[model samples]
Target: ALTWWNSHVRIVGNDAADVMTWIELKKKMADTYCPRNEMKKIESEFWNLEVQEESDRVERYIGGLPDSIHGSVTASKPKTMQEATEMTTGLMDKKICTYAERQAANKRKFEDTSRNNQGQQQPPKRQDVAREYAAGSGSRPLCPKCNFNHDGPCTPRCYKCNKIGHLSHDCRSPTNANVAKNLRGNGAGQKVTCYKCGAQGHFK
Candidate 1:
């Protein structure tokens, strides 16, 4: 820059030098380094530039850039290519962070849903089943045959005859001890089996 200034700017006459300004200096430099014909040729090349090959480099990088990055950079209206690249990098980082957060949230939701389904699928306890059968009685249901809070089949005891393996209403024994005593005194052997001793002609 000093060599060009000394050779081109310093040699002007006193009257011509008086009229020279910074803008005039810049225009002279532009005219010398970038001629009108060369500028036109560069413009033409920029318009014709394509990314047909993987290793192409254009003077205007934005012209050959992919739409995804180019559109974003253009929307931000960056004044320079460096600013556009920085914006692109920041956008990608923000996108990655949001995706990671969403993935973590989805994973947590899936785990919670799985736990709920497992709890729902568990079999009910025996006492819980009995309570449900009780129909809001707030207690376990009683077995009709045994009249007790139990589940499944059972050998019932007779309330009337004081014997096991049968219900009171189905007992075949005499109704009371007095009836058996009267039958015995009259010598009437009814051939009934005793539930206690398994012997005939007696009742227990």
Candidate 2:
């Protein structure tokens, strides 16, 4: 079975040295695989050889470029193989830059809107001042007669003199001297007692 497989193995290369190298490597692999574990190792090596061939094909398609372009094709850099190819070839950088700029502008707009909303939601200092003024004015003392503050006009009346514009405490009305005489004359028909001398002629 090994001899048939070796006979059927095909190599495509114009270089005689390369063809001889492949033949020798294949012969060594077949000779080294005597046990099942060694056979598994050989299979793994064949798989590795196939992967290397595919990698070489991809590298040939990408072509030889500068280190900068080569770095862009790495798995850690581009999002996909196609994107890596496009970036390496300078086909999509402009579009990517424009999209990034638009995204940044949108982010800035969102931040500005959030800031304005916060400012509008907060109460203003002038409103707080007005509220404090109203509360202070409501708590101040008012005049008893006019129900106004002290700054308002005075319109109080004096109860003793029955006069407007002055309180009873500051009244200047004089006492009437004819009050007793008028009372005696009005009570002429009645007997009034004089409490000073215990006589029944006039009231004290």
Q: lDDT winner among the candidates?
A: 1
Estimated TM-score per prediction? Answer: 0.30, 0.25
User: Total backbone clashes of model 1?
Assistant: 0
The TM-score of predicted model 2 comes to: 0.25
Worst 10-residue lDDT window for candidate 2 reads 173-182
lDDT tens per residue, model 1, 39-142 = 99999999997756332322255555566566776677666656766787887788789999999999999999999998888788987875565655436566
Model 2, runs deviating above 4 Å: 1-43, 46-92, 107-130, 137-204
Off by over 4 Å in 1: 1-70, 122-204
Top model number, TM-score: 1
What are the clashing pairs of model 1?
A: none
- Each model's RMSD to truth, in Å? 21.3, 26.2
CA shift of 164, model 1, Å: 21
The lDDT, on a scale of 0 to 1, for candidate 1 is: 0.69
Total backbone collisions for each predicted model = 0, 0
